[model samples]
Target: MGRAIVATAALSALLAVCGCTVQGTDADGKHHLPVRIELPGAKASPSATASTPGTPSAAPAANVLWSRGDSGSGVRELQARLRQADWLFDGPTGTYDDLTEQAVAGFQGKRGLPKTGETDKVTWQRLVKMTHEPGKWDLYLMGGQPAGAPDPRCLTGRVLCIDKTTRTLRWMIDGRTVSTMSVRFGAQYTPTRDGVFHVYWKARNWVSTLYNSPMPYAMFFSGGQAVHYSYDFSARGYAGGSHGCVNVRDEAAIASLFAQVRTGDKVVVHR
Candidate 1:
């Protein structure tokens, strides 16, 4: 009996080492040992599937209405309108490039539309109307001049109206308005004030000392108001909308305006 008990104890110890435990006996009076199976270095399944490194997860493709460079009258017309509206550059040369894509995205973002960078019917319609009639002002109100006002000079060679309402800067040569282009402005909290001012100074690729904003063509007009290029051209003029600075849309427009306007150019702002 003592030898039998020792043998049973030894068997139980061996089973424990092997991760096996004695369970309740079956109806046939046979002892059952349950095995605790384990896989070496096994990892549990993740709650979510791991995404591919550096690759964004699959997202539903945006509904594209217009193809890039679809040779058609409609496409050409849309491209032309976009160019005129300053939503695109170099007027629809029948070639779609990075500039065109960017302009489309900008237009879509401005109108509170989908930013698919595709010229759809809706986008086309908006561009056409906007380009045709850039400004919709019944009255152009000039702000009151402060005490000891200096003599206002008329630098009328090429006058550019940085419209606060349409978020566009229009160029007028010899009192004849030539072209207008869209522009971004300051935040809703801090906007470009309305008043008659002049281009006091010029700075190429000027960065703001107050904010993280980059002004490519800095044409200083008022105390802080200037005509400059901004990344946020999504807000095309609706209100007194700039950080006391008139913001233009693209680099091309900025360059053009800067080249035309010199130091002490007349910058008239009105309602």
Candidate 2:
């Protein structure tokens, strides 16, 4: 009996190493014990609900979407569309990085879709219709330049000259453009107001009283609208919106702008 017990334990250890399971040893009698084993490279029998012979088992992706970290032409196309909308600052790099995600989320918000920085079927379709199919140069940004012609109003004194057509914000000092950056506007409903305005307020770390969202480095120009840093803009890129305020994605740029801009600097938001 002692020999048998030692043999059983040793066999069990051996079976474990061999990837085999011992069964029906409830009574500890080796005579009635059963073992089930599967050899390497052997496959289990399919169930009745399995696919028919000669048919492909994997389903084609129907809801295929692109988000951050993915790479390919899809991401390139997404970047092009966003550039057309002035949401994507850089040219397409063929990889869906954080900037791509930001652009997608901003676009989604403008269209009143869920602010999930992903390129779903619906988002793709809408973007395709709205933006021109990008040429090779457009995607790669071989020669893309910011709008140079500032409005006459922006030529004198200190001014934040923003142009929707150019998709640029030119920081002007004494009739000369000092700085420029890619910018985006609000949705059709909550459009960033156009025309000349003045900075009425400045909040270094402002939270929206209405939207309950952060508006850091805010320089208020029109009513509740302000020029501020948006992490949504920074993280998601052009894929988000402000509540009628100018959304600057670059945190460092906005921080500098917030500091330099006075309480009544000229803000010209124009076409």
Candidate 3:
């Protein structure tokens, strides 16, 4: 009886071991115990989430800074900025000539700024904030005695008026009325003298012997008064401004006028 009990006990132990199945499969179609593995983020390891397709990446914003000075590059940059702001002047050539000075003064005056010809940090900042808006100004002509009819000397040409109120300059050209930038004039003592004259001559890189002023693309309209590039205080477009001269603040514009105008071209200046 004891021998039979021992054999039965051994057989029961073998059956229990055989009935315990493992999770893995083998080449012989037999199961085996699997190797233990701890999942990521299961208190054993850390992992990041994978990125998906069609996800947009954020872009950086534009960063703009203001600058100033008379360096060639800086001047060019300022000119470009002014042009972009619809200041329709000339390209910066690094020469702080009369035209550039005039344009700068005009720009400052239009913005209610102090009419200093020099550009400063505030000017740079203001220029950056400027926008391209169409400008208009009211002008008056003051030449020749007033009669019921147009004076014979009053040749068929347009008079340009620079309006201080609106900061714009308007004129008639080629039978078409047009407007441009606004500028300052001289004070009562040296107001832009009224006259009826003709473009008698043109001088590129012109130098004024009377005032020792250098005029770029000077177009003679009166005796000593001609339309030329200047940066004098007259850019304010006030009264009694010039020393018998019509000052323009844009060199490119003067160049344009030089290209189109000829001797005997009539110019009428009014109040």
Best candidate, TM-score: 2
Residue by residue across 116-226, what tens digits does model 3's lDDT show? 766777787888677433221111111111122223333346544333333233444544444353334445666655556667888988787977878777777667767
lDDT value, candidate 1, whole model: 0.60
- Higher-lDDT candidate of 2 and 3: 2
- Per-residue lDDT for 1-271 in model 2, tens only? 9999999999877886675756764455555545555555665334422455888655434454887789877787788888888888875668898888888899989999888898889989999999898865466442223576999999888999998776678899988887787676786789999999998899999899999999899888988988887777665554455568888776787778778889889999999
CA lDDT scores, all candidates in order: 0.60, 0.78, 0.53
What stretches of model 2 exceed 4 Å from their correct place? Answer: 1-132, 135-145
Give per-residue lDDT, candidate 3, residue 53: 65
RMSD of 3: 19.6
* TM-score to native of every candidate shown: 0.42, 0.52, 0.37
Model 1 — which ten-residue stretch has the worst lDDT? 138-147
In lDDT terms, how accurate is model 2? 0.78
Clashing pairs in 1: 165-237, 167-237, 186-242, 191-242, 192-242
Q: Model 1, residue 187: what's the lDDT? A: 70
- Models, CA RMSD each: 20.7, 15.3, 19.6
